[model samples]
Target: ASNAYGNSVGRLVRLAVIILFIYAGLLGLTGLGFKIVPGGFLPTQDRGYAIVFAQLPDASSLDRTQAVVDKISKIAHETPGILNTVEFAGFNLFGG
Candidate 1:
């Protein structure tokens, strides 16, 4: 039976089956890759600095916000992994 298939036609059939198997494996791997990948389109990298935002109101005084921010900053400085704290008060971030 094996000797009967030892011919050009047999070789072609065997090659076709091998190619089909490779294609199937690649398709399965691609599906698996999709499942493992994260949803965001943006690639992630560590950002050393982080911005902390505080808001009071449209009528809130800059000085009041600054005082609050200063207290928060002092606390942040005492915390580990906090290299520094930059206060961003109000809408401008610079906060007038």
Candidate 2:
């Protein structure tokens, strides 16, 4: 009789452990399952302004990069509200 009681108590303990794990899993699912943020901050197509691309001649060497820099600087000087200017050259063209 005592052995039967022990067996029944062990079964009940295992069932309780499984039930606790299932409940914890459900709580975690509820915490992480829903979407709060929308897809994008801005529209994909509605650009406020146009982007201008200027490519230098392929014969451009290290020295010729200065001419490209000068041209870009002149453009920056002519344009208003130029927040930033960046130049890419040589290996960085492939790197970036």
Candidate 3:
């Protein structure tokens, strides 16, 4: 009886792990199609996102920076996998 109980518990634990892995795999597969193609997952080497520090003397005026931001936003919007973007502008000194 003791051995049987231990065996059943072990089997249940293995089954639970297998079910969890299968669920995860299925959920992950749904996004597999989007992993490739333009605007999709970018490798670490990609310089696609550039963070500009506000303190730089050569930083463009707010309007010019906004123009650049808009351009990038448009590009992202037109891309297939990009869902949305949230941009925030804060006081240059305190925010960074």
Candidate 4:
């Protein structure tokens, strides 16, 4: 409403000049490698994170799920440098 047409037209004039400056900056950086990278964001594809997601059948019982989760937790805890390993068994991690 007010922002669309209520402000001074002087704002429009300054906006056009600002746009021209931006265009000039882009044009001035042309032919430089810094202007653009050829590939996607992770072109080299070096990403690091650790997580484990396991899926059993939708009809899996809570006991069976807990058994599987316990095995995983035991395995992870046995590994070196695993300070803490929290697990979510099915939908009830804290135990039903």
- On TM-score, the candidate that comes out on top is 1
Q: Can you give the TM-score per candidate against the true fold?
A: 0.45, 0.35, 0.34, 0.42
Model 4 off-target regions past 4 Å? Answer: 1-49, 92-96
- lDDT tens per residue, model 3, 1-96: 999999999999999999999999988886785575455467667865644433433555777666666776777789886677656443353544
Clashing pairs in 3: none
For candidate 2, the TM-score is 0.35
lDDT, candidate 2, 1-96, per-residue tens: 999999999999999999999999998887675454344766666554534455566767866776666687678757886666665444343433
- Compared with the true structure, the alpha-carbon lDDT of candidate 1 equals 0.80
Runs of candidate 2 exceeding 4 Å displacement: 34-96
Ranked by lDDT, top first: 1, 4, 2, 3
How many residue pairs clash in all the candidates, one count each?
A: 0, 0, 0, 0
Q: Count clashing pairs, candidate 1.
A: 0
lDDT of each residue in 1-96, candidate 4, tens digit only:
667674766688899999999998887787565557665565566543346766778789989989998999899889886777878777743344
- For TM-score, candidate 1 versus 4, the one ahead is 1
Task: Tell me the tens digit of each residue's lDDT in model 1 across 1-96.
Answer: 667667877889999999999999999999999899975675566576677777677788988988888888998999998886666655564646
lDDT of each: 0.80, 0.69, 0.68, 0.76
Find the candidate with the highest lDDT and give its number: 1
